[model samples]
Target: MNNKEKADEYFSKNKSKIKDSDRPVYHFTPDIGWMNDPNGFSYFNGEYHLFYQYNPYDIKWGPMHWGHAKTRDFVNWDRLPVALAPDDEIKGQCFSGTAITDNDKHILVYTVHSNDKEEQTVEIGDGVNYKAVSDKPVIGIDKLPKGFGGVDFRDPKIWKEDNVYYCIASAKNDRGFGSILLFESKDLLEWKYVGILFENDGKYGKMWECPDFFKLGNKYVLVISVMGMQARKRKYFNGHQVIYFVGTYDKSSYKFIPNGRGKTFDFGFDFYAPQSLYAGGRTLSVAWLHDWSNDLTLDGAKWCGQTTFPRELKLEGNDIYQMPAGELESHYKNKYHTSFILNRNKEYIDNDLNSRTARFDFDIENIDADKLTLFLAANDEYNSFIKINMKKKTLKFSRRFSGLCKDAIDERKIDIDICDGQLSLSVLVDRFSIEIFVNKGKEVLTSRIYTPLDANEIRFLADGKLKIDVSKNEIE
Candidate 1:
């Protein structure tokens, strides 16, 4: 049988084994096996297609294939057949890359990583069915630019500019530093090297994995996931983390001049390798919502890994703000609103505000408290809390007591400026993830939790009296 037939058979056999309790209601999780590094997030033929690194037979990472899903509004998703698989003759894995709509065909550009040679080769495919345009690499190791000699090249992100296609791929320099290489293609078949776009000066990390470059408003943004960086004094733990550089791109010279130091894309523990697509006149991005250090408890669960809710990227000054895609508001229902004042040393637990999937909007003013806390996914044994300190102007997410599977990186904190002594926040809670938007998305945090499925209580606490207006909406 062909690769498509094999994938269909494997998915059919294991799809029934997935535990319903472990799956997310709104987030995109594979029907079976393991998934990571969201690849090819793009819109083609009136549908949004999302592909990822997939292994169909197990809950752990293995032989890679491109798992596929499509959505019309970014809320409801349809899992399609697997798109790409490693050919028998390739003797390697199909790694991460991007997709684009070219000449009415879905073009997939990805890396064929061969562990035997410790090198990578680029390949492209056409149509929804990924038939390789060529069996050999269009751009190989011999074509790489100078100063880049490491074997860590992968994850090509492609975009079109004034009828010419540009590709930015992650690479490693001869000295083991992370870098991004630029390539230009006219017909999506042959590619020419266009100098190095940017590289780490030893301050970021050793190797970069996924690199995405795009224009948000007037400035150009480059997002990448860096590996082997230390976690000391950072919001994320030591391992793979995603960061973005806001800068200006000189299209004439193909040069990128960053404005300042790169900033953390998501001030959370579980976001990485985010890829964006231009849809509905906005840039929407999704990421792998699992961390590297967490232990997998997949003894009976047939599937693992999920993608974050699609976020709309907006640029305000040098900072990027992420809000849930506007289409997602259609899924919200059962709106509840309340206003209250919590005195010092008081804790309010709202048992009625129970939902495994919900959206919360909080407008807090008249601040007389040093600290304010909100608990979500709360139950008798598990709960995650978002703590905000007025004096320090910081927000911290703590999941230490949320459930089992304890790790040292269960908590993440970041400093933010509270605007006008008031806090406006929005929180989206899915089954296994929580996305917190603080001060109208000025600073956003995305976290993944393993709390119990029945943990649906909401609680509020304060150190002193404060007035707040809270609204909750259950998402269908």
Candidate 2:
């Protein structure tokens, strides 16, 4: 079947298995299609609005459009009509962009694709960037930029500080180094080209997708997800990773002072395309929780893509730590189960599948082994599976689906390790993605995997010798 058909079939088979359809956990996949990039995240009039890159046409990847959804409490979401869809003149479709509220209007600046129509040739003009205005998106494709480089030059991130709007976009150079192009707008219409903020020096990767620029505390954080970067020292994959550079931004020169070097935000097998928004007094981040290299079972179930939990970011000394947002605790009303331990061994514990969603915690201290493995099953015996292995100082994950009658476990991995003192790991396993935070976001691992929802089994194993405390919280 085609991708649309496949997605429909997949959603039909597994929609019921999704956790808290009425109230969503920080981790869950789009019900029928694909979603990426957290957009238009703002709390206005006591409501939280979240827009994203969505392609409803397929369970797998395809032409992307702006998908809209909102929540009053950030837990129960109501899907709204798509904010932006590609009109005929646009070549392939809508590309990534950001949404900002200006005065009364919600101004959205996005890159529109005309690549397919404009043949790939130097002779052809660059692609176009447009402004999507919505008092209801009725006006449609309000304003566009003058030289667009096909669809490749897309994903606009917009922000305003003193009333003037600024945007940063991802562009590929002739030599293929991913770069960020800067622009300034007065009325959110006409944009003046500013100098390039940063570019890949063959250090990180080729293409930088979803570049988010924001201020945290007294420092600036430039977050970008890239594809095709080799590990300089430590990393699991040869392609696709998210890295960040924490520095100070000088608006006068429009340059950022490098505090040190760039590093991977999460040292896991999966985690890419992270976007941050300043909410309350803290800067909260949510990322697309899947990688290009791993299969999300979209082929079998047809639905795909997931978002990591809201992480509260803070600048600690010279490093940043990400912890689950405090608001997320509101979901713990039901409290199906909880576990705690000061010290332990092969402490294998299991809890009833009381609720569809859960928050699992492990406090680990004392390390003597070269490797450690923690497995979760629906039962105490055999079969049902979700395995997390810390081998050679790397964190790895694997799982088996309930529908697929395969004895072989499908391995979907994210590698991360702890530093200095004791390490605490929190895992949120929904229908699709597994969002793991190590040592309170020192290294996070977000991977999209498909497993039987009913397979509510959890197991813990240590390779050598270590002390671990475990707790599981089910959503009310």
Among these predicted structures, which one has the highest lDDT? 1
State the lDDT of candidate 1 residue by residue for 410-440, as single tens digits. Answer: 7888888886668898998998888899888
Local distance difference test, each candidate:
0.82, 0.61
lDDT measured at residue 357 in model 1 versus the true structure, 0 to 100 = 91
Clashes of each: 0, 18
User: Across residues 78-137, which tens digit of lDDT does each residue of candidate 2 receive?
Assistant: 666565555543344566666655554555666665644211100010111223332221
Which ten-residue region of model 1 has the weakest summed lDDT? 116-125
Question: Whole-model lDDT for model 1 versus the true structure?
Answer: 0.82
* Residue 413 in candidate 1, Cα distance off native in Å: 1.5
TM-score of each: 0.96, 0.79
Query: Which whole-number lDDT from 0 to 100 does residue 378 have in model 2?
Result: 42
Q: Output the worst ten-in-a-row residue range by lDDT, candidate 2.
A: 119-128
